[model samples]
Every structure is written in C-alpha cells, then in structure tokens.
Target: MSVESKTNAQVMTRVTVIGAVVDGLLGLLKIGVGFVSQSHALVADGVHSLSDLGTDVLVILAAKWSNEEPDANHPYGHDRIETLATLILGSVLLAVAGGIFYDSLQRFFDPSVAIELGIAAFAITVASIVSKEAIYRYTRHYAQLLNSKLLMANAWHSRTDALSSIAVLVGLIGVSFDLIWLDALAALIVAVFIAKIALTLLWDAMQELIDTALPEDQVTAIRAVALDVPGLRDVHHIRTRTMAGKTLMDLHLQVDPRVSVSEGHEIGCWVAASIRAQFQEITDITFHIDPEDDAEMDQEGPTSLRPLRREVLECLRADWGPLVDDAQIRLHYLRGAVDVEVVTSQPVTADVLKSKSRAVWLGRVTVLHPTVGDN
Candidate 1:
C-alpha cells in the first residue's frame, strides 16, 4: 500500500501509542520480577524491552515528520525521513545486541556465580513471551498491510524480545535438568537473533536511500501503461524512485511527429492520468515527449540551415518555376532542420518538387495535392 492520505498519520499514532504503553509496562514488570527472583536472564530481557521503547519513539517522530507535505524548499516532500528513521532503529538494535553479547561473554568466563530461580520468574518469563509475541504479531500484520518498512523493523524488534523471553524460559527449565550454563547460553542466542534482525533492516534501508529502481516486472508494467495511451507510440528511458513513501517516475514518451504541440500536450495528460489510475503507488510522473526516439532522430541532422524565407523563395523560383506570390509555405524549425509544408503554384509536379526540397534540407516536406494549385 501507498501513503494515500494524512489518515495514515492517525493509524501510526494509534499503533505507536499502544506499543509504547505495553512495552513500558512489560519492561517494568520483568525488571521488578527478575530482581526479586534473582534471575539475570529476566533482568536482561527487561532491559531489552526498555531499549525497544526508544525505537518506539523513533517511529512516532518519523511518522510525524515524514508526513509533511511538499514545500517550496523541499518539493519532493519529507519521505526520506522515514528511511533515516529505519536506519536509526537498526543502529539501536545493534547497540542493544552488542550489550547483550558482551554481558553474556563476561558471565560465560566467570566461574563463581549464583542464580536462584523462583516460581515467580517462570510465570514472568511465560507472560513476557506471550505478551511480546502478541505485540509482534499485531505490529507485523499492519506493517505488511500498509507496506511500512519502519513499522516492520519495529515489529521484528518486538519479535526478538519475545524470542529472548522464550530462550530465558527454556534456560530456566534446563537448569532443572542440572544444565545451569544454559541460562547464560540463552542470552547469547538472543544476541544472535537481534544482530540478524538489525543487519537485515540496515540493508533494506540502504537500498532505498541509494535511489534504486523498481523491479523489472514493475518497470515493464509501467511501460505498458504508457504505451497503451492512445497517442503514445513508445515508452523508454523509464526510471523510478520512491519519494514520501510513493513511487515517482520520469520517462521519455514517443509521439507522432505530425501532431501539433497542443495535441502532444493533450496526449501527455492522458498518459499521466492513465498510469496513475493503473498504479496507485505512483505519485508523480514526468513525461518527456519526443517526436521520435533518439536513434530515429539521429537521421535528421542540424535542423536549422539558416536559410532566410527570402532565400527559400529565391531557391524555389529558380529551381522549379515562378512562385505565385500568394502561395502558402509553412516552415517548421525541427530537430536542427526546417521542415516545409507548402501549397504549390505548379499544377503538374508538386510532389517531385517537395521531395527535392526535403532532400536538399534533410528534413520533411509535404505537398498538399498531386494537382498542386490547379488542374
């Protein structure tokens, strides 16, 4: 889905607020319960939950700032704000994972350590897992529905927390089987999961920040939409970028050479409207209308020959016949040459004369009739 309207801001606000409240309460509950029951794993899990609260703030601020409308200074709107926000969320997760790994490593080396597990720790761990999983599922569902990467990153962050609590629960049960070191191992496992999530988010954001184009299939679809327009002959040089959470494109559109400029512009309007109707993600499109593509245009060199109108008349009169002063000749400066359209005074051979003029100027010339001015 694309950013359809400002109503997305309302949806974002609702989700972030719910997440913040739940995470904060859960962090406090686990920390308080772990300290009372002397479970280091639960305490670390609680700290991770608190750390997620920071990312919640990132989502809120990003959602607010990125929704700003386009302005004179920033004509593209504020979309990249969300991209940078996702980057910061990934960075925070990395720092959190580093802390988890370092603490676990220290505990792994120390020989003298005492841990006491109470029934309350078990209850807290199970509750943490179930609650955090609920949060993850809720956030992830909407993130995919809305196609929001920022929201999706936060969802994974929640998922890691849930998985950490599950590890803690398993480790607590392992200690029952006389495997006490499993408790410490659980922290290391949590660190590994968090690191993977961080790296994935960073890579996705990097791709968007670098202005990557859409996939080939999507580009082909865009071309098809353009070509389907009534007056468009071909579409090429299509490039795409995402701006403010929507697609923007610029492409060259081939049009009939004989069409008037006003007609070409009218065709351009239809092309834009048709594509926008076909692809909801597209917010802006730039159409560069061409009489022909570059390869075909190369055949017409130096459109302007610097021939004055007086020189054209003198050439026509000397080469063909006396020009009736009232004959209409229209010269169009094109590509770098002048195209001629004329109603000739000579009745017998205007087509041959027009063809000769076109060959001389290296441009198109059309004689109105085979009969020229008279029978």
Candidate 2:
C-alpha cells in the first residue's frame, strides 16, 4: 500500500492499543471497587468502560481492513469499513446506555437499594476520571492531527466515560449522605450522555456510508484549484465526498482545443496533483477535459460557421507552423455544422494529428492530404 495508508494504519494501531490497555485496566479496577463497595452505579460505570474495550478492538480491526487496496468487489477500497465499524460501535453504546437507564428506572420505582460508600469506590472513581481525561486529551490530539472521524468518535467516547466516572463520583458522595436515589439519578444522567454521544456518532457515520457530499467550502476549494491550470477555461460538475478517512473528488475542466492530447492529459494530472498537495485529506481525483472556442465570439453573423473554420486554421498554423503551408478554410452554414482542411508539404499521419485538429475545430474539421509535388 501507499505510504499514507501505512502511516494512518500505524497511528490507528497505536491509538487502539493504548485505548485497549487503559480501558481494560480501568474496567478491572472499577469492577473490583464496585463489587467490594456494593455500589450499583459504580458497577454500571465499570460495564460502560468494559464496552469501550470492545470498541477499541473494533477500531483496530476496522483500521486494518480499511487500509486494503481497491478490488473488483470494492472499487473504492475498504474505507467504508471504518464507517461500518463505527456504526456498530455506536449501536453498542446505545444498547449499553439503554440497559443502564432501564436499571436506573427500576431502582427509581422499587427504591429497595442499599447505600454504601467506601474508600475503594471513591478512589476508583477518581482514578477513572484522571485516566479517562488523560486518554481523552491524548486521543483528541491525534484525532485532530489525523482528521479522522473514527478517532474523534473514539475520543468523545473517552470523554463520555470520563463523564460517567464523574457521575459515579457524585453518586458515591451522595450515598455517604444517605441519599440513595441520587445514585440512581446519577446513573440515569450518565446513560443520557452515552445515548447522546452514540446518536451523534451514528448520524456522522451514516452520512459517510451514504456518500454524502462534502461541505461547500471544500467543494469550492477543489474547483478553484482545477480552474487555475494554464489552459483550463472553465470548471463544472465538481464533486467531493469522504471515503473512509479521505476525500474523493471528480470534476470536468474546460481547456483550449488547440492543446495536444498529451498536454490535456498533463493538465488533468496537474490539477489532481495540486489538490493532493494542497489538501491532505484528498486521496483520489478524476477530471474530464473539454476544449474551448475563441474565434466564435469574434464573428458578426448570427450562428455563422465561418468564424469556426478561421479558428481551426489559426490553431493549425499555431500548432504545425511551417509544416502546414497550403490551407483551406471551409464552412457549411447548416445548423450545428463545421468543416476545415489543411494541406501540408509532406504526408501527415492522421493518428498523430486528428484529435488535436478536431479539438481546435470543435470536432468539426476534415483534413485532406494533397499530392506532395502538386501542393
């Protein structure tokens, strides 16, 4: 694969490994403390952290698969694998949140709960806060640096865990005051926050999976780059979308018809290269070249074909120079009609010159080769 793909994979791997290690440790600590202190809220928070471990694993798997090269089955590569994994992770979070909320509601109605506060539960909560906050900052730093939606989602996931830990801390303190309902209330609040984060992640992932167009500002930037090419006359049909962690684009660019095929191809390559150089997110591009007409605007008669023929001759003279000596400009006044011819000193191969000449005449010229001595 490409250097870019390798680098992204390495970064993702590091983040996922860190997430798994930290979350596993935190989950074990919370579960241990929760069981010792008989705190339902603390236990629920532990379960939440445990779920994060699963998400980290999924991230690692998705990053691995999403870096695969394009194939017949997936012409755009496996970028959407990341989106699919994110969707699954979000759904899992929603389910966990729902379960916690259900349990909290049960406690709310039954009110048959034991209030227990201990040093262990409080220490675990504080540790969770510190660890999760640190992970949040670390993950967010890389997320922004990589501009990865998946990493950002994971970072916010860490934030949600931290928020849950804070709720556990509050609940544990309330239990010390003999207010058991506050513990259940805190659990409910934590569940709500998790649900919110899950919904946001789901929405963003769905947008990417459906191939939604990028923001207007980015689309405009792509067009600006394409139009800046030397021979390009106009740009249209510009499109942009996110695939996996990168941007994919396609556009149609107008150029001078007199330019050779290789020159036109070079212009397309330049436009693509410029976009890739300017924007790190752009990973692929395709452009169509359209030729422009100059002399059509110089003529006076309405819909006259003479100006087109004149433009063709001028273009041939500019392109072929002394090789084309005897040239005749012809025109048919019928609707959507054009024809022109150039007589050169030697036999000119059609394969080498046809497209270039036709492009100059807007695909309306006919070149005739006369006897060399007669010409």
lDDT of each: 0.77, 0.75
Top model number, lDDT: 1
Q: For residues 1-375, could you state the per-residue lDDT of candidate 2 as single tens digits?
A: 578787887898898789789998888777788887787656766777887888898888888888877889999899888888888878877886797688778767876753357888788889988888899899899878877777777887888778767766777787788777886898799899889999998999999888899998988877787778787777777777887678898877767665767898898898888888888788888877765432343244345444554565566667666554555444432233344444444566645555555442244445566665673
Clashing pairs in 1: 302-336, 303-336, 303-337, 304-336, 304-337
Candidate 1: residue 292 Cα off by (Å): 0.6
Q: Give the clashing pairs for model 2.
A: none
What is the clash count for each candidate, in the order shown?
Answer: 5, 0
Which residue runs does candidate 1 get wrong by more than 4 Å?
1-4, 38-41, 111-116, 295-336, 343-362, 367-375
Off by over 4 Å in 2: 38-44, 292-338, 345-375
